[model samples]
Target: MSEKTVIDLSRLRKPDYNGSVQELYFLEEHPEWMVCKTMPGGSVFDVGTIFSIPNSDICRTALRHKIYSLLETPEEWENIYGHICRKYARDKEFLAFLSEGPLEDFRLRGADTHHLGMIDRDTGEVYRKSFPPHPSQYVLVKKYKIIKPSRVSYNDNHLWDYSEYYGADKFVVPLENIVRIGLTSGSSIYRNYLNMNDAERKNYLKELGLREELVPWTLFAKPVVDFTTKYEPEDRSLKLQEALHVSGSSGKKLLDIIKMCILGAILVSEFFRKIGLFLWDLKWEIARDGDKLVFVDTIDTDSIRVTTKANYNNKDYFVNFNKQSMRDYYKIMHSQWFEATKSAKAAALKSGKSFLEHLRAGQAEGYYPGTPQVDRRFIDIQEDKFNTLIAYIYGQATLDSTIEKYNEIGLKEIGYYDANGVLEEYDKLNGMGEETVVRSQ
Candidate 1:
């Protein structure tokens, strides 16, 4: 449905000229496709997306993806082009790298894919900050001329030092605060979801450089760090060229977003620390709109580590607050739960039942085979922890507002893990009703 247009940057550079973007327009014919188009009301611009391609110049592919993400694209494909649609486009520096890296030597590593990312910038509405994966791609010739920019490699990323570990990608990130230490008494290895019977399973474990006595699963290792960041299309340095920009509204907004992000990062970091859990990884990113600060990203699931109290069980295992732990624990449950689920599935098959029917039947029949009193693990643990975290964040808003939401659900506390007295009835604010007044407890 929409027309396709391609502008070749094969010659954006010239030996005689220093070059100027002032004389060029990336989307002159398709101004709407530009990520930062001025809005109709004149108050804001549509901060949109870019397009991408696979097995080509990653920077260029990411650049195109950044553009396409913010605008419209063809909904259906008619051919098997081996193309994948990945959201969260790279930042401007990446495009420059593709445009002007040393043509003969520039290579993109698997880790290079995460230099920077952009999410949901097309609309000026409420945004949901997402974690990474999938990338838009653009195919380019193996041999091409290079037109370099003063800035290249979009991120001053923190590349992981797990060179001896598995996988080519090593968790490269920018603005990451990390403290690496050599393994003294123990070694840690990251896990991949290879089938239990996969041929490489033995090799994968062997690569951890393990000794005969070190039980691999008992090692106290940190969780995988999933990086998150706001996709700022244009850097502040370029915007400063427009005016005495440090005092400019946009510049101030950028500063505000960064400050708020840091505050949030520190807040959670301290909360977990107080619980005797040390978080080795906490990431934050922000996008700006005038004076407003948008908290763009915070790594969830893999973000926190609930370190088991050392020596409590004589097996110091560090529990990462994530889904995998729940799934694995569920799979290994005392065989009773597993058998019940199998029986329920068979009964459903004989009855010609759908998922909902099976679920209701299972629940009515007490298919999970639980005693009235029980010890919880896995899903039960993660659910309570996640719910408490959710409550704490929301509970930070106005006491009256938080109470309003709390009352609607008839929930005094979102869950047992809420430790801050978030919905306690005896609190001064919760005690006051039907009248707005300033009072002391």
Candidate 2:
């Protein structure tokens, strides 16, 4: 079990002065230590004898001792304690206002808890400045007002609940469960995880076969962007082919690559249909866990750029746009495509041209043929299936509308709605694959 640590700022002592003083004096004198230690990268800053507190019981006890040793005067103690009391009083008032007003109306959905820090028992509120792993570092805090009475009351009442401030204390894991903690953010928590001692880290890696090297959690790490910006697509594609050749997987071929590309595009289309926003680009980080190729990293607004309309909108809206549902959709669709195309040599025999031709004929202008010829018939079938799935998820005729527009050019029965308010499956005609089935009036 990992050791636990506690840095009690309230018990700190003042420097130089010698008498019974309150803990607040020591904190006020070393406010920088209290505030800055929690800031991003602030842990590296050591003042005199104080090392930034580590998450361990021994370290916490030592820190507490050092703080007590610093405090020595009653006058200094009273001043600091008085100031702290006033600050707490102000915070309490704000908490009351929060409960009575906007907080009451605040609708929280899909809420997940993160451990900021411990709560002050007397004040009944967690100090925001001290909660983050690094208190001195600042990130932009998104602030908005609410107006629900119940939400306000809940917020106010919940302030007293320390459990609400500090989420589940223990990291509960079953004996045989494979728990992999991927570091995908540059947050302090990630840093702490990365800074674990060699032995501790080795134990963690043993469970998941994850390498110890630290990968930067930046959007720039995306393979697509890296390939497009640093090297020519043809050069990168050639490199990828070379890598595949060296791996000697007989099943992995140019056709498989093309299929993956098509599947990715289809997934993107579906994502746009549901979110009502078009993803400009996406970078997929795939890893094989046993027989499954799972996607890692977040797939949201931060990772990808999205536009509501074909053009940009100037209006500001509070929606996250980066919903988890969209991520799940991408994962599911990608997995399905991977399975479907595993043995698809026929699609590759046509040199990607067949798929392009079919896709072009089925859709009018503006839709680019993603791959060279393969099989237009299979391409049309995939497109229809993709459209149907999108309609089902989004409850909109995104596929139907596009198909209707393209029907004048030749594409027919792209998608249709069912009486159950779901996208209906297409009918297969002449074994050419299914076309969209529209609902009967």
Candidate 3:
């Protein structure tokens, strides 16, 4: 394993008041912070990562609440959010979080979002997710997507034509597949568990030593690509089977399959994600129900990467911010890193080091492409301030108020501290004083 390196966050400063203890704890303990399939050991950081923003739900929500104006078209959104990103990026606490390398994990997470995180199954069948930098094996899951048939709406079809067709989710699965809660996708698993047969489910939960309604995220069964007899075309079917086989493989076998998929991944990037957030199109299930992986498709994560010109790449390749100026900053760093790596890889030939080995030795974990050194007007802020700003943005962007309401309902339904802790933490992390606004802005 590469030695973990943290970011050089001298820009952001601390705040007067202490940030929320619980919120800080969650950031520290989030499973992505740990090594895969192991506890007590920490995972190395990846700085090439950027936040995912595929859909317009956050924009719509902000618009509805007057956080965005009607004139705030997609182009306008870029300007507003770009400003927000640049401002927050310099916050001290946010810097600290980024230093820990939480941003690079390929799981879909956020408070107000529709989807949940990935499931880590005991059977060792983790969900197959693809990244722009690298892609893994993928299951078709939704058969209808590949071959469109009747029973689909016209309006949705128009929109669907532009969306990434292959998808998955863990919102609902069979009773037997339900295992422990996942780090990110626990919300979806628990919600699916609610729909299971209650009487048998209770007995099963007792046997598992979990309260009938306890939230055991981290260990879970997520929804994956499963193809059934509903589709035609023998070649396509064979191709999908190949995809699944590759997705289930390990070591070099996995890398081989990923290279093949990369052929179509660029197109997947073009149509599906405006910000290259392929994670939006994926929701792999770990439910080992002894059934064949079906070839059914379901359009989820509100796929539509609408953006104005040069919004996604002119600035930052990882995140478009749907804006220009912000993108430039991102682009400089990302392109520099990629170029540096390309040079590094060539140089490593003399050292007999592979590219992966090169990255581990040089610029992989704890490496943000071009930052701190690149920015001219760098600030030396306090750490507490960074915490306040991050907590505020995370809570608000994830729909803090809505989550609190849902938390209240879950408490009434299940009556557990864990039931409400997610939202409770959100509450504690958000709503800083006016100083937060002045400092960040």
Candidate 4:
């Protein structure tokens, strides 16, 4: 057993950053530590999973730490977490968040209970009997305090948004994001390339004017956007800081971060594979650590998407263990509002406006549909499924006793409603291995 360390965050400072999904703060005692708390906006909007999100978050975070700790050399570990933080160590609080059983059991079982004396940020009292009904929504990870250099800025460039292109915007660089996609059908790149022949695919790449180095990866099962290049034709080179519209700092570059992400993906994918699930894709949030880029935020079921191997050959291939269900619920139950949002977003993009802007305008004009409240029955079903998924993943419950039943319900709903039309379109696109390469374990 490892030695225990105290985690006194009672002197926690106000959040340094207020992100869309989570807030970032540091403790007075452990100044190097970063404390993350999930917020209501972004992904948590529909289902109201503020309290429960941390349960999944801490589990995956600990799992990542476990995988990375297996590295033999200090250099190997440094390549990933060195410049950002020396290590990833879990105290009593981390374990407490994940403990479904009594906290006393963990102490009795020889687990380090040092951080058990941790004071709650809100109440400023140590947990005595057990954790609250739902443990505190916090992601506690040790990280180096990034001292900003006089010449460089870590603001804009550091927040790398690896997402799909809803429109041409300051944040949404379609070409760059397309290159970062994985094999999952949820990616627009995957769906777009699903039906194209090699020649047509080649033409498509040429039409988009993608860099030659990136062309090879566009069709790969996992495309890591590591190639160094200029985003524009006339530019000599694309400096990381300049590309992100920031200044410069001092060890590794963008490619280094991309390599780390790939390594993380492999580690996560292998772990899930062992548990009879395939890790599909991930939404990475990396920040500049002085001179290095390190992954921040959580890596739970919320950030990563996974599917069962049983659906590998079926139309429901990319059906995942995430908020896709909530999305499907909207598509089926509130089709008008869903269609209206899509149309309004498209129009907004055409006029060089954002979806948010369109939403505001549409509401004022009585044209945009308001997001209807989700039925209480649907929300209950989803919460039950989420709990069962966590329980199933952690070995607290058997598969058939939990997620399997929910999976059946989910499949039936999605299939019957033809939610998102992914299944039918996939079938029409010629099923598995027809036009594109369907790589699987």
Candidate 5:
């Protein structure tokens, strides 16, 4: 662990976008002086931020930029931005007409326009045909801007607010297995795959194999792939809508961003495949910079799910080298608590109360169980696995052992290479080969 910076409580203020795990703080003088505070020993069912890893944010941010660098295309960026400009123009036109037209007449026309899905919010439902930096890199604060102001320590141990200085808020857009080499077909393919019945899926796979001249059933059974946007539930979405001015077009834009995320996923998967790991599925945190979308936050094991070829088909959902493994353990082992939590949450929402308050009430009445204590062995194993994964991701691990493990698992027949080149590949794949130009100050 690194040395702690003594913070003065008077200088900091909380932001509206604080999450369950991470709290956002801004300097009273400079609101842009963003600090992300991750709670220590704060586990949701004993699986969360490992405080031992002090520079976790820096590493995760670097990793996100690496994945996004794969999508960078200087020539095409202008064309892409033009489309957003056009969409914004259309939105402005609608707003002007709404302001000028008679209230009764505009209301009648608005219903018809909405029914046909002509324009979504003020942004419109527009998508780019090619993959460009959908969410280009948006740097909130530079490394130099991050300060460890100290010497004035105040005792606030009751709430451990040790944090990394940076930005906040998030929106996740996930691309599943269905996104292949070309995302020309778009999210329709994802929707089709997700909605397929058992018989339909079998027939579709058979037809796909026949069309592509492939024979192996194993190919089709590899993993389910599709692109989807994760949105907060109604209450949460309403809060975001009110707070951030988020509209329907924001969600639509995220769906468009999925294509870029798909490309990044392919690049990342290829890199992971080199080291005896398979990128199962990962979610991306994106935000808007003016009219252009950009990748934000970190893409680490927490945002992704990983598994071996051997264990991918497991019904137990035993994810290898990912936080999902911890979540799966709790879901299976602590069913009573899990069920109680769901009930309490539902009851809380029903009565317009917070989940914690409802849970405490239930516990006092002896109707709900307390939070389960995770096994010590599980915690130890999770910590070790996370550390090992971090080492591998950072390219600090001895590739020889990972290569041997890869061969032992019979992945060599799939592809084999010299271990020495893995480091070289890591630097290139991670966008560390050249000096990174900071996009924002």
Candidate 6:
């Protein structure tokens, strides 16, 4: 919402015989003068000048007089030009002329490249008109069916628009809701863990049940040890010095090991609930925006790896073994999860039963619990179904089996910390390490 200035209408007059009534009226309504002229081959130039001038009395008087003359004079198209020019003079910066004539002429000439007409759902024909921008960009439009509406694709239709048109409520869930929980913490856990000082490194190893001497014997142990010693004092220069001491190969090896542990922590925290039916191995990107480490990428199925319950078990309970496969699998799994939830809801409503009851029935009938219902809205079921879904996806579920299952699927690391000294790590067992190198290069 920026301020706009009006152009004087009288300055637009050229040595034409008369003026146009329609043009005069347009200037009166839209004091912001726009240039509209025909081109050589029936083309039109409809351009708006980007200039502003103070709305003054002289310009107002000229506008009124020019408009009056255009109306009074019969076939007086010349008067319209006078009014338009006067309007244009009010705004000095209104310089550039966008040609509407070309667009209009292009349409009139039956240009095959012009697919500008909008289809009217009611008439099933093209509707030629101007469309304005909406306050919200998320609005979508869709058609209703006689019996059941067909599934809509996000790419093909606007979810918000369709929801509004169909009387379905649309809510703007903030992008923050999809953010990883650990990212809310200020420190980059992966980077901090990787850059741990000797004491911190020993502490970490102790957590993993490794003795002091045993730590150095592990693969990539030197870098981990160095990281511990470097970051222990929070001394920036010292940490860099220590990091520089390690060879690139050692850094890569240590980074891989750290990433695995961090991925384990994330998987343990977020994607545990969907463990049994679907594997969740997702690419995670984090950045230090201000003092916080924020996840900045799509956590959808496309960025993650997912597998069917059968396939996962058949493959010995593995998820994304590589970054590409991991992301691809997650995309499919996420889509499937969404579809399953929709189907389950539809089934429950159709049967006039609660989702949990329907799920219980399905379980009895030997159907896999595709998105289990944790609670009933009608009654205060202990487990909130929606909350359960959120918890499961974010790896906040209480079930140990769920946690173990996702871990078995192999979480791969994919991103690093930002410039604010936030530590980053990625899962390396699944070739995520290789994918990261390829993408970075």
lDDT of 4 by residue, 135-245 (tens): 344545545433221222253222222222122121212112113433444444444555688776676455433433222112343334322221221112233444333
CA displacement after TM-score superposition, residue 295 of candidate 3 (Å): 14
Q: lDDT (CA) for every model shown?
A: 0.28, 0.26, 0.25, 0.43, 0.38, 0.27
User: After superposition, which runs of candidate 6 have C-alpha atoms over 4 Å from their true positions?
Assistant: 1-269, 275-281, 308-441
Candidate 5 residue lDDT tens string, 1-441 = 022223343344555345544455554544433444432232343223322323333334334444444334332333333433453364664334223322222123211000000111122221121111221111122111212212222452111121221132231222121333221111234335456787766665453332232221112222222333233221221122222222223444533444344434544676566666666566554443344444444455656655554221121111245554544444455667767766876675565445767777887898887667765545554555444544555566887766555333322211111132332222221111112111110
- TM-scores of the candidates are 0.24, 0.20, 0.22, 0.57, 0.48, 0.18
| lDDT of each residue in 309-358, candidate 2, tens digit only | 11112221111122212222222323333232222323323332233243
How well does candidate 6 score on lDDT at residue 276? 43
As for candidate 4, its clashing pairs are: none
lDDT of 3 by residue, 1-441 (tens): 133222212211332212111001111323222111101111111222233222222222221122111111233333323443454465655334322221222112211111111122222122222111111111112111122322323532311121121232222121111111121211233434567797866864554334425332222221122111221111021123343332333234322223212211222333323222222122222211122222111121211111111111122111111222223333333456545555655545445334456665665455524322333221111112122222333343244543343333322222221243332322222212233212211
lDDT of 1: 0.28
Tell me, what's the RMSD of every candidate? 23.0, 27.8, 25.5, 12.2, 18.1, 29.8
33-107 per-residue lDDT for model 6 (tens digits): 222221111000110111111211122222222222222232332332343245445444321121122222222
Candidate 6, residue 5: Cα displacement in angstroms equals: 28
Best by TM-score: 4
Among the numbered candidates, top lDDT falls to 4
Model 5 segments beyond 4 Å from truth?
A: 1-18, 27-247, 250-255, 309-318, 348-352, 403-441
* Candidate 4 lDDT trough over 10 residues, lowest sum: 169-178
Q: After TM-score superposition, what is the CA distance of residue 368 in candidate 3 from its true location, in Å?
A: 13
